[model samples]
Target: METQMGTVEDNEGNTYQTVTIGAQTWLAENLRATKFQDGSAVNTGFIPKDDDANLLTFGRLYDWHDVIDERNICPKGWRVATDNDWKLLERAIGISELEVNKEGWRGKNDIAITLKAAQPDTIFKKFNQADVNKFHFFATPAGVKLGNWYITQDMYTEFWTGSSATEKDAYARTLAYSWWNSHKGQIRRAKLQKSNMFSVRCVKI
Candidate 1:
């Protein structure tokens, strides 16, 4: 538990937060990968091709299709997190995946909240954004709109994991202040689209 802190610079010179958890070093935020570590598009759209399908929010929520790609989307030495990797973080925090979205914060499983950055003043470019970024994760609204806005009671912070929920859908990690202060998981079943925004935190091997 002696955590070492530092920064990892991407090819674009983007310095991301880094932390040591257990024996693994992890990014304190999600991977907003706009392109492959080599500068290729990461978004999988309708036709699932180039930058046109690239995402603006949450930086493109990839499915198993893109994840399993051996080319690897993350920077050199880093790759997108798999479902199993997601599980380890939950285990270390003493939380269960099934209970992640139970509509409230559980003190026992609030580690995810601790990682979220304080809510900003604006979300999805909307005015007067909310969220205190209590955790350094600094999760922005990133606004995952399904139908008529899919925001829950406290729709301030949202996050996405590398694991897919189903064939076309994937799992998203989130938390709210309105509830009892716990972390939650959401399964997105729609196709990938740009315009949505989210934060990225990575884990190192």
Candidate 2:
């Protein structure tokens, strides 16, 4: 039988799920693509050309509009995932919610730790236990932007959720590393932080 590509680990471990989708073995990690997958020239000025590559460990942040542009971003066998694709993952991990958590959060709540990357030092603190990730998600708090204004570093990992708002400011989902519960996910926009450059993680769809 074919097993799923990803593995489950606690937030304290450094493992991430690398799945094979459509003949491609890919990381479940956030895309940190500095260049469009085809090696084409992409604009890095959105982020400082000199930002420490290591700290932006996932990949260069792309706006929702950019991800929408088919010109390029994902590799040959892959495409940037859609909202439906993410929903599938959430379902797989039993994180689905037709309603909301006590916090009135929008998306599912069960998969937070499963999606968190192992960073014990950075894991959100809840009750008394720091997340051991327990889901191989290794989610990190890469600071984001408001059009060149870098904002919150130690608290948020606002990522492009492949969904959009009605306006120019793109829609995104943020996971707070300092908080105790994953139920409090925040969704925000691009124009709100056009200055902050963060990380990327693409899904194979």
Candidate 3:
């Protein structure tokens, strides 16, 4: 597959690099918009520890309510990445057709490594400079906001898919370091609470 690159600006004038992986074009970084396209504020977002600096690197975490809002958090011509969008990315990165749609952790041949950003930190047990982050998706362990507490700042990262599994839960994708000592990484598909806060990535519509 050919990889194409470009840039986009959101409502708040925040610019993001975009990468074309397979047939879809996705934001290379997590979204950091505070307002909708029509100039409406998204009041549900929260920054970790009230640090405004984190907005540029980690982006703001938002609940599912803000994700599916009609005002649209993403820039014009783009939308929050959906469950099928994630599956397409998985298949493009080497996951088999059979495993791409399965729930729980489903990836093969270091797929997680290919999707994560190559950070020089101890959060990952193993690091491969050559094969990691081949697509420039730049997945980071931005952690998440649960209720009033922020946890897992550098351990793992989860992105909310625009697909809903139920009224109270929605689908999401997770990338994390394996518990055992190894270079291999893991990706998971799970349904989480709609109130839980997670990062968002936009896909070109």
Candidate 4:
């Protein structure tokens, strides 16, 4: 397989490495920009960098509102991955396009094992297992934040899709270390409340 790597700069001046998978260019890291495209502060659901190590690894957690802001959360030339964008990624990895766009928890449970990043031995040393990472997407287990509490720090990983399912809920994708294979256990397409926070990954426009 052939791969090309590059870099993109955010409005905040943070540079992220970009990897081309199939025809799509994806950020090799989670978005850590603290401002929108216009340079306005992103105040809500932005986790402060109390721990530089975690911030560097996971990037920032953002709510759906922050993601869809007209000012734009991603860096210039890139935008948050929409449902279709994610479907394209899945298809690139050999998942049927038929299973790609399905709304709720679709696709075989093994897709997560394919796209999920290999957990660092420095962080998850006990779990010696590594992900297949067929496309070099480098999706880490950044976990999610709920209100004042941070839960599932190292166990579960989720990313927000630009598509909103309803006024109250938005679409997202997830991978979990637990139950690596059960009928709908590992990878799931979830419709979560807009306020629920998850990590963001951007796709080139």
Candidate 5:
């Protein structure tokens, strides 16, 4: 695909790279905004205790509540990708839309291969670089913050979806570097508690 690259600046003046994927335009980088578009701070969002340097690389991890906040976490004219929005993006990239709306572990299209970034050999032995920017998704392994100190940095990354699976649980997508498959990574949708902090990737409205 002929991907068009661009840039977007958040209300706070933090700029992010943007990429056009099929019919949609997305933030090529994970969101690192500390405030909502309305200028309200996301006080509940977790910023790793002492890891300021990694924040730029991984972006801030936010709780589901922070995502659902009416103030809006995304920049103006953009919003967090909804579950249906994710489905549309996947189908645009050729993944079947059959399981797109399913609650947990949906799809069998090797979605991870096309979305994740190429890792260094030190991180994974059989890393595949073929699809790193094939579609310009450029997903990174930013990991998650689940109450304990940041765990699995460079090993796993998850993005919060705007859809809520239940009153207390929400939908999200995850990408992981696994040793089981000879260090290959995978991506899928799953439900998570409202309190779990994960990365956010926004889509243009």
Candidate 6:
């Protein structure tokens, strides 16, 4: 697992640090661009109140439509990570190939904690388990945007995969603490509604 670090600027002129884990290179930060590469507005989804600071920390949330649009939400030479891309990342971090493809909470050996940013008030902190951020992925608890409200800002986070699971839903990965009993600090593969909004992380093509 050779690792490399670098920087890239998106079409919005916002620059993000990038990291290479295993064979894939990824944006170390969540994407905050509000427009597509073609200069079209990405649906704002739902911006929470006092989000001026949150925008910098957590990045903007986008529905699946914005993710799959041909105009491109990620920077040049990069794309939203596909489901398989995520599996590669999981394997790089020590999850077995068998567990990476599972549909629910997966991974052993505190693998989910390895992806979360080390914040003082995060769920990992509550359990006295430090979020190592071993791969420098910097996943924040940006939460999710539902129909007219935002929920769980600092307790959980999810990312949309470019792959679709059904006409109405798409594949996603989730990180949470005690979301369901006994499922603390693990990653989940989910089929989520396309209309709901989640954080985005780009991978180099």
lDDT of each: 0.46, 0.49, 0.85, 0.75, 0.77, 0.83
TM-scores of the candidates are 0.58, 0.65, 0.92, 0.85, 0.88, 0.90
> lDDT tens string, model 1, 9-43?
66655567777655566776545555566677765
Q: Which lDDT tens digits does candidate 6 get at residues 67-92?
A: 99998999999999999999999988
Per-candidate clash tally: 30, 38, 0, 0, 0, 0
Please tell me which model should have the higher lDDT, number 4 or number 5. Answer: 5
Best model per lDDT: 3
Residue pairs clashing in model 5 are none
lDDT of 6 at 11: 81
Number of the candidate with higher lDDT, 5 or 6? 6
| Residue 115 lDDT (model 6) | 79
* Residue ranges of candidate 5 with Cα displaced over 4 Å: 103-109, 119-128, 181-185
Worst lDDT run of 10 residues, candidate 1, spans 45-54
Cα deviation at 75, candidate 4, in Å, is 1.0
Ranking by TM-score: 3, 6, 5, 4, 2, 1
- Which model, 3 or 5, shows the larger lDDT? 3
Compose the digit string of candidate 5's lDDT tens values, residues 11-107.
9998999999888999988898889988989965565544788767777899988887888999999999998888888777766657666655544
Mind giving the per-residue lDDT tens digits that candidate 4 earns over 76-179? 88899997788887777666767776655555535555565663333322332444565566677677877876777667778998899999989898876543
Model 5 TM:
0.88
What local lDDT does model 5 show for residue 182? 39
Between candidates 4 and 6, which one is better according to TM-score?
Answer: 6
Cα-based RMSD of candidate 3:
2.3
